[model samples]
Target chain A: MRAVEPEIVVVDYGAGNLRSVAKALERLGASPRVTSDPRALLRARGVVLPGVGSSGTAMAALEERRLVEPLRELMARGTPFFGVCLGMQLLFQTSEEDPRPCLGILPGRVRRLPGGLKVPHMGWNQVALLRPHPVFQDVPSGSEFYFVHSYYGEPADASLALGTTDYGVTFCSAVARGNLVATQFHPEKSGPTGLRLYENFLRLLVLEEARPLPWR
Target chain B: MLAKRIIPCLDVDAGRVVKGVRFLDHRDAGDPVELAAFYDREGADEVVFYDISASAQGRGIMRDVVARTAEQLFIPLAVGGGLRTVQDMRLMLKAGADKVSINTAAVQNPDLIGQGAAAFGRQCIVLGMDTLRVPGSSPPRWEVRTHTGRGGGRPTGLDAVEWAVRAVELGAGEIVVNSMDADGTQQGYDLDLLRAVSRAVSVPVVASGGAGDLEHLYQAIALGEADAVLAASIFHFRLYSIAQAKEYLAQRGVPVRRVPVPSGDR
Candidate 1:
């Protein structure tokens, strides 16, 4: 018996750490296609934008690969989308780290952590759940997730934030709006709790929706 | 608040995890991939794999070990030792390592740090500093010693604190200060050295080497002001489990990740 390949596309724009994300998906029995082609993204039952690095370079790479427009279109079409680390930052309008406009899919600004604190808020930190969401099912409200970034996103709409974490400031650590989901921490790198989040996202939003109706 | 990290470093040689006393006389610990999985399950905040192999052949095995470890292990994995170029760092990151630590190579070629940060964000690059105390200095200064174990130990003549600042300027996101004087002795971390570097750089400082008990781990974070503590022997020899170490720290009011023990484990 052959296993069907998962129609999940992990966006690759020359950023590092994509392999870890892909491997996590594979562990959950998904043969995720790591591609930068916008067409592949459009056809995916779910799209995962996983990135690490500065916004300047990440945005440049996305623009160069011709993925910006397609990503916007995918979100508009209500496809299940998940963003990790800088991928989540790019959804906002601007970043203080770099003087460039982001995808602007969501309204917000990415700003640096307050001075005197460690630049990269590296290590495990608790994510306090803002509301009940299926993506965080079984994962406790104060569960710690691995975070490695200097800048954090501040969405104009506070209600958009699904989870918040405190370093020097209490900021949005995870965001959800309809079909779009994103996290500042790397769930792929965050032990078993992290794997559960991925599983929940895949099962609830991606796989469950993709299942054919019983009548069909 | 960010939980203080407890990292268990695996000194790997020829694809096997081996621990050395003062970087001499190695003893086999176990297979790299299996030991890594064990640590991940036991609740290590992050795992570091320092490839101590002398040959290119041994380096080749690390990629496979890392790839396999990434498949099952869900924590951040850092690979160090012998990574000199941006391409080398890329090989590790592409092999599923979340971060790459550089020691000897970073000192020899400082630009390697900047180039790595430019290529793969500063967060991906870690500056591993091995320091030795000067015989007699009024202020107790230490110098950076590169290639510091087994046919290595070349002095760079740069002050440890000064060099840490320079590395951060050159784009190292985190600094791991390993005290050569205290490495295998496990007397305690070189508190003076760690405090100096931790205060000098705005980036997070990781205390490495010389952790004999849970108290040493506590001192590294409480007094030394280190963002994280990296120890090899204590956790490696099973004198204390990662959970026990975190519990000890938490008792003292140190914010440590208290990972809930999954049912049927331990």
Candidate 2:
């Protein structure tokens, strides 16, 4: 039986957490296509960028596949874009890792979190919503999400920050501006509450198509 | 929030499921594929198939069983026992095992842990340690044992709990602390061992051995602070269905996935 659901694309840039994110989207009744294919990504109602591991390596893969420019173009069109973990970090201007250049999609520098916070904060942490976004519509203010990362992004414009979490210090945990949304936590591993976020994203896709685009 | 996981451990020997008293009953339980399918339907969060037999013939049989079970089950599956080399881990992973566990091999060569983690991400590697409390020891020290609980060697000169902490630092994504004192006892989980290990490590801990009933599973979560509870004999014998176990745990306030009951089988 063919399933009728909104099509979503998860950017598989030879990184980590692609399968888990795809499965979580599936559970939310969205047909998620895990691909590095820029054409499919642009065609989707929304796109999820997921990554784990070094930022330098991730950027290289995206560059090699010629996805860096395409992704930027998609965001220019204001298609809803969500970045996760390293996926969230790559949207910034640069990273501390080798070669140091990033997509520069968001005006920010990705730096390693200072010592004493424990590298790769590998556990559940509570996130406080700063700006209201469609993704956090149903999600509570202090909802906990699963996070595993060594570095964090610091957006030049604090207005882009959608949520903040405290580890060694309060830092940006999620960001959203216009059709862009990104989270440092792996929503796929965050259990039921995380699943609800993905479901809300799917709902936003439906809503976006039903209503006229303000930019259009 | 981190998702709570429910895992079922299957003790396989010579390509078949085996259960007994203190790992010696030697009775044929059922086909590994059939049992895995049943567990998947019962909403088992994941399945672990431990190849207890280290013999060459037994190893061959285990590969076949892992392949069959992988084909039948969908959720994450982990395979352990006699996984000595990176190739061994890679083979199991290719056979559909989501994670590969190492015990004696890891102890023999601690570098294997880091090597495996580098080859495959830490999330796909697990360090399974067999532990037992030392007799007449002050402050209660737990020691590591090997060879299917037959001998203790090298001691790793490390405390059981401390070793677990080091294992995660050495790039183990998860730790499985199986208590020698609790294996097949069915009395209850050794909560003290579980608590110590769970506290010592930041990553998820799977409590194995000594889970006898529904209450035992609940205690493992509430008291031991374990992420998952693994049992062999109880599930093998049909003493408690996975559905019933999950329902009971969920009712007791332990976070568990609700599995639908099979039609005409309840």
Candidate 3:
């Protein structure tokens, strides 16, 4: 008997290193479909919204593909969703980089990181866990993760913050609200600790699949 | 606090790592992929593959090396050397380079910086600056050189500090300050140049081309104000392992990431 890998949909908004995210997922034994297709996302066991573009461009790309509503609905419907960097930023309603409105999935706004340090905050930084989430399973406290961002998520509800990191001041680096998990750092590019995060998220999807749904 | 990154640079020429680093794990240091995996296990914060492949024939091999290394590395992989077009940037990013450093081409065409930043966020578009102290300039000006800091072409006459500030304005997310005169000296970094550029630009500045000891690394961060220090000979020769460097930095209050050491070595 052959084991089955979950079909994780890597959203391609025409921005972001989708190939890198997909390759990372593949390395973890999951079949990831890189697509802008709403239908693929609708049936996806997990959705990874990865980005490396300005918020305006990423939103415009999603709007161009008519995926704005579908994406919001998918995340709202409790799919194992993951957002990274600008992907995490776009989950909020607005950004300092651009005036364009985002998905507004999470009740927050993306603000520029503290300028007292490097604007990009590019390099390895450690995150201190405020609360345990499934995503950080097997990850050590203060394990370094690679980061490259000018902005970070400022969730309106501070309770949603799962982890906090410091650039100049302490800010939310990872957030968890139900099954939707997002990180200010690129876990995919963060080495073994990063791969462990992906593996943990995959296990969450597998667990969700194994759960006995009330409807079923 | 953000931990200072210790990045070991691999110079790839004709599809092989040319630095000749003999690792206890990997048999061939020339194999970029194997060496990358070894570094990954060694607790390296990131790995930079400086592709020195100048020929068209070597481009295919370069991409293959990047793909295989990317497959194994979970850390940020930065690629540079002869990336002239947006397509070249896209190909490497798709092949798994977390960032693309454009040096010579960026100098020839300044718009490439903005175009890259617009197409693929500024985070991945690194402006690699090779510098040289001009012979007869007031205020001790440093000029930008391309083609791996060869130092004999159509001189732009753009001051290094001004070039860095302008590059940031042009959407460059990061700046790598490589001193051509100090490239192989291993004396120490050009602190005056680094402090000037770091003060001029808000983006992270990576100090490259000169590093002989652990003190050089700490000084690059503490005195030079560099966000990261890029070294080749020091790391390749095992003069200091990433773990040891981080421990030393941590002891000196430099805030370096502690790369976990192998049990047997302990």
Candidate 4:
């Protein structure tokens, strides 16, 4: 069966960097629609929750848009969801920066990186692939991805980690469990290497769409 | 495994690339678009365009320059100087700058950092601090300066290292600590200043100002632990090519991205 191009829904919770993320997706030939509507997110074949701000504000925005429950349901239904930076952190149970709790999709606490190594780990750093995953299909094992974050998600399950990076110590940079894929790094800002990853994501979207209806 | 970065800093004034002797004396460097393209081809990991002109005329010029440079350069471009509002940052990003750096504006309104980070992801915001070494101390204290190293009214009085840590906490993803004392010296990096800031922040620290040669670049990464090094005279004058600098660093056990040379050249 010929694969249908997947429509990408970029969750716009008022705090995410939607423009660049959408531009990157469009470059990969994926139809991207930046929307706050939970229905659009539910209907889309793939969801990209691209965030850039604080955990508290992000959570508030998601809750305000009423996307929290729908997103959880989408994840449970095996929708291909990719989160970047704060979007990735929001997948956890809670964050130290904000008092409010997170989605509790991933079991972990997002805490600040220890002092002396810098607060926001910015710029491009190398990603060491831990396990084979579709998102990193064509990407090399030690490919560099741009990262900018202060706190990182410490997922309770080690098996969920797909890649790890070292700043002061080895920390999870990308995570994958079943159909959910998220990266702490901003693949949109990571140049050609990053663009390639997005392209690979589009390919994954094609595969997900080609699967039998019952499985999908 | 952190990949080393090659960054080229363009001093923009009235929308033109300007180079100076001590960050005070100014001379036209080149068109930002042309220079950015040159650096991109020469294997620059990233490019920074510092708007040296804070005047109304300079702002207009910077907007045009940013648009032009962003069109040609595919790598990350960080634009700074005179960014005071969300609009200022928005203008630059819309004009093609991937990241926006704030120095004076950030000091004036500390919340601007968080606001900008929130508006444009933290990865797209940079805090550029102009630091000076205050004499007569065991560790030699570093202090933040503003207004092109001119009148900022008694400095911010914040410790440079501590301020960097706080800046990151406030949502600044990268820190560029430019040493006023080392500016235009072309001797070496202000190791003391670089080390203190690097030790304080976990994010990538870019050492700007006094880089004279390949050794200086190597020292900044090795001794100063800088993730990236920014220089003006060396690259602006064609004293060293980006590939040559990377080659020198690679020989010294410093990990750098290997740019494939042309087959004929090989």
Candidate 5:
């Protein structure tokens, strides 16, 4: 008999790189379902919201697919949620890239990287880990991760930031609060160190879910 | 600080990796998938696969190659060559390519850049320019060339610097300045063209063509002000490994991503 792999849902809302994110999860031996359906998201053992592009369009795509409220509800209930790139920015209250309100799950606005610097802060940059986190477990602090974006999330409360990276101006690169986690960089595209990040996130999800309740 | 990217470009024809000198005289390298994985293992920052084949059937084969390659590596894969429309961009991106580079088609349509960016976002669109220096032009100016499909380099009469700035305005996230005069010569990059475009655009500029040695790569960044350097012969011919080139740069105060050690080596 074959062992059943946990079903991880990758939210697909017409944003780019869904397959890349799904393939990375598949490489880690998990069965990833790429879907825009809210029901699929709710039933997922783990949910990854991977994105590229502008926050305004992404928010619109999520709204068009009716995934906005469900994603918000999932995060509110402490679901194991991982957001990447624009997915990380969409969790904010608003984005300067497009004049649209984001999910507002986190209390902050996404702002453009300061002027006089190249936009889309493309290529590899080091993420300075603020404190130990499970998802980044075994990943060294100040390690470089793949990033391609023009704007970054600025949380109203500073403690939500998990890591920060510098370009012209230092900005929050990763954030975690309770079961929710997100990275401004693309761990799925960051090679081995990135693959390890996925492994850590998946391992933590599986271990926590496999624990038997005291009542049982 | 962002690490300067060292990209190994694989010019793919049909299904195999091939290299051309000044967009002529094709030389077979190896399988695209294997070569990409090898580069990834060697700690290459990113790999670019340009589908040099012109036939429609060849395009289909490139898609398959992209799909197979995407399954193996976790790093970013950028696919270019003959991509014309937003649908074409969508097809390549769907096939697992992180970015789609538009060249000849972009020069003809121009709106395709904005359309692809609007449909898929600006980060997915890369503007590829084959530039040649206008002979005896005062202060040295470069003009754009396209139609590289059949080894034919057609002059577009557009200034390279002005076009780069315009393309960025049309929503291109990155620009690849491939100097036709310098390509395949392995002498060095056309620093003048690279610097002109780099200084004009607010987006990241990649210097391509004519990287003979480590010094050329360093010159592309330090002097040329290129955000990244794309080389083919130096890496494909095994003259210099990505690790060696990166080590050369890192030692000279240029920030580069440290090559991750293998598990056993650790």
Candidate 6:
């Protein structure tokens, strides 16, 4: 018997720079639909909240499309969720880039990358994995991932931290709780190691098919 | 700490990758998609493709090129040249390009920079500034050159370093400072120009043009203080590869992205 292919929905909230993410998923045999419609969000086997802009604008885009509640509902229902960059930031309560309220699915404030350490933190940086999650299976402990963000999530609950990378201040790179996972780096642009992470994420979906994810 | 990036720039004209010398003397290098995959396997931090030919007919081919390159590699791909409108940017970004660089077009409409940053966010809007020293200026300052010199060159009085800061203020997340004076010269980078721009900008500055040897690349980082260095001819002509450049940078103490060292060579 063959396993059903995961139908991943890449949330499109008008915060462009998502095609790369969708393309990466397509390469791994997952047909990801880039959509803002709430109905699609409900049906997705996996949901990717990929973002690349200020939190205020990003939240406004989500609000305009009325996806704020449906996304929360998707998580409440235990859909395997993934968020990238601003997408990861929006999963938290609030952000320094703006006063807009986030999904609050996770607890934290997305603060600026301190006062100094290079504004965008652009380039490949090594991530030190703190936890042994399935997403990181077969991936090395100190593998490098491409990063391009000015702010990182500071989750109120320290246990959510899975990977941390240092600039001037060491910050959280990947966080997880149950089957849901999010990352501050752009895995799609991170070369083969990045592709491995996605491959690992897809494996999580495969695992979900056998065992429905438990609620956090 | 974030490692310094060594980016290989693939300047493409028509459908094939071409090398640009001083933004002129376009010569065939290889297929854009093939070269990009090679660079990715060799451990390039990122790959930038400038669609030098923005012909009305060549536009479709360029999009296909960007799409094809993105299909093969996971590294960041930035395409510039011939993008005059936000729709042009939209087309490329939708074609799997992570960033859309604006050069002559940005100079023509400065507001376009802010527009791109507003629409796509600052990170996607890269300001590609081509600079050259004012021919008869008393203080010998670098001016932003508007034309590719393929057309008659138009040098703006705007100082390159100051313009970089203004462009960032307007929403350019990163700046690529290409020295017109040293672009094809390959003697070395315009360290003086690079150091000046690197000091002034709060955002990351990509020191482009004039890379002949590994030492030149090292200086672009260590002395020039550029956040990243862009190379064309040397890599195109086989004088150096991105792997060798990274190895040399490692030996010189400048932190860079590491690739698995191939066996049997030092």
**Pairs that collide, model 2:** none
Comparing candidate 4 with candidate 5, which one achieves the higher lDDT?
Answer: 5
**Residues A118-212, candidate 2, lDDT per residue (tens digit)?**
34455566789986788887677877676767689999999999999887778899998888899998777655567667777877788777655
Model 5: fnat (fraction of native contacts): 0.86
Model 1 Cα lDDT, one tens digit per residue, B218-264: 99999999999999999877889889999999999999887755423
Candidate 1: clashing pairs of residues: B147-B153
Which of the two candidates, 4 or 6, achieves a greater DockQ against the reference?
Answer: 6
**Which lDDT tens digits does candidate 3 get at residues B76-134?**
89999989999999888888888999988998999999999877888889999988889
Model 3 residue B223 lDDT score: 93
Mark the regions of model 5 whose C-alpha exceeds 4 Å error after superposition: A1-4, A212-216, B20-29, B149-152, B262-266
RMSD of each: 3.4, 6.4, 2.5, 5.1, 3.2, 3.9
Residues B1-266, model 4: lDDT tens digits:
55678798888888767763222124233678877767766777788888878588889889888877664455678898888899999988878787899998888899999998878777778899988788786768988987764543347788899899999899888899888888888989898889888888867889998999999999899999898898878887788888999899989998776553321242
Which is superior by TM-score, 2 or 4?
Answer: 4
lDDT of 2 by residue, B1-266 (tens): 33356678887888877763132234334677777766777667678888978598898888888777654454667899889999998778766676899998888888888888877667778899888888887777788876763554345556789888888888888889888888879998889989998877767788998988989989988999988888877876678877788788878877555553332242
Of 1 and 5, the candidate ahead on DockQ is 5
- Badly placed stretches (over 4 Å) of model 1 are A1-6, A206-216, B20-29, B261-266
Provide the clash count, candidate 1: 1
Residue A9 lDDT in candidate 6:
92
Clashes of each: 1, 0, 1, 4, 0, 0
Q: Candidate order by DockQ, highest to lowest?
A: 5, 1, 3, 6, 4, 2
TM-score of 2: 0.70
**Candidates' chain B TM-scores in the order shown:** 0.94, 0.90, 0.94, 0.91, 0.94, 0.91
Q: Each prediction's TM-score against the native?
A: 0.94, 0.70, 0.93, 0.82, 0.95, 0.93
Predicted model 2 interface RMSD: 6.8
Q: Distance from true position, residue A85, model 1, in Å?
A: 0.9
Q: Write the per-residue lDDT of candidate 3 for residues A54-165, one digit (tens) a residue.
A: 7888899999998899889887778899998888898888888788899999899998876577788888889999888888986767777888888888999999999999
Candidate 4 collision pairs: A117-B201, A117-B202, A118-B201, A118-B202
**Candidates 5 and 6, the one with greater DockQ:** 5
Tens digits of lDDT, candidate 1, A106-159: 999999989879889999999999998888988889999999999999999998
Docking class of 5: medium
